[model samples]
Target: MIKPIVKDQQLLAKKAVPATKTDRPIAADLIDTLNAHQTECVGMAANMIGSNKKIIIARLGPLNVVMFNPQITAKSNPYQTEEGCLSLIGKRPTKRYQKITVKFFNQAWQPQTLFLTDFAAEIVQHELDHCNGIII
Candidate 1:
């Protein structure tokens, strides 16, 4: 289902909780929502759909990567750029890392690690910020 994007600042400011096995559906929902808005967005987080779970779907080129309980284990080389959010008003200048290593669960609930760089890393960081209750 493509859930409505939450626009409430107070709600978006609340930190998302880690996902459990039961929250697997949220991952699918995130992917569906991202696909529905593929042209307008590169990523969607569980919190954006009003479910405060640590889940995010990011479009890295032609692929939609769905992750649960995602956390940035390492990052390097900071860079500043403008970014927009589906749940926020306008684009804002944000700082992001050029490279990042994340630990997360796949859609099947298996542990996964990804080494990302450039735009892919930036997109993941943006979604991760949503999980941490930050909008930029």
Candidate 2:
């Protein structure tokens, strides 16, 4: 289901809990919502869709990758940049990493680790911040 984009700062600020197998539907919803907003958004967190679960979807090239309980284990090459959110009014200045190593579960519930850089890394970092209750 394509869920509504949640704009309530209070709700988006709440830290998301770890996602489990039962939350599979939420991941599906995230994918659907991300696709729906593709023209203006590159990524989305579960909180943005009113689900406080550690789930996020990122548009990587032609594919949309969903990460469950995504954790940035390592990051480097920090830089400052402005970003816009589907749930926020305007772009905000924030720190981001050019490179990041993440650990998470895939849609199949299998553990996976990925090394990302450049825009991909930034998008994941932003969504991870949402998972950690960071508004920016």
In terms of TM-score, the best-performing candidate is 2
lDDT of 1 by residue, 1-136 (tens): 8889899989888999988999988877888888888878999889999899989999988889899999999999999999987777788999999999999999888999999999999999999999999967
Index of the highest-lDDT prediction:
2
TM-score, cand. 2: 0.98
lDDT of candidate model 1 versus the reference: 0.90
Write the residue-wise lDDT of candidate 2 on 47-118 in tens digits.
Answer: 999999999999888989999999999999999999999899999999999999999999999999999999
The C-alpha RMSD of each candidate to the native structure, in angstroms, is: 0.8, 0.6
lDDT of each: 0.90, 0.93
Among residues 3 or more apart in sequence or in different chains, the pairs in candidate 1 whose N, CA or C atoms overlap within 3 Å are: none
Error of 1 at 83 (Å): 0.4
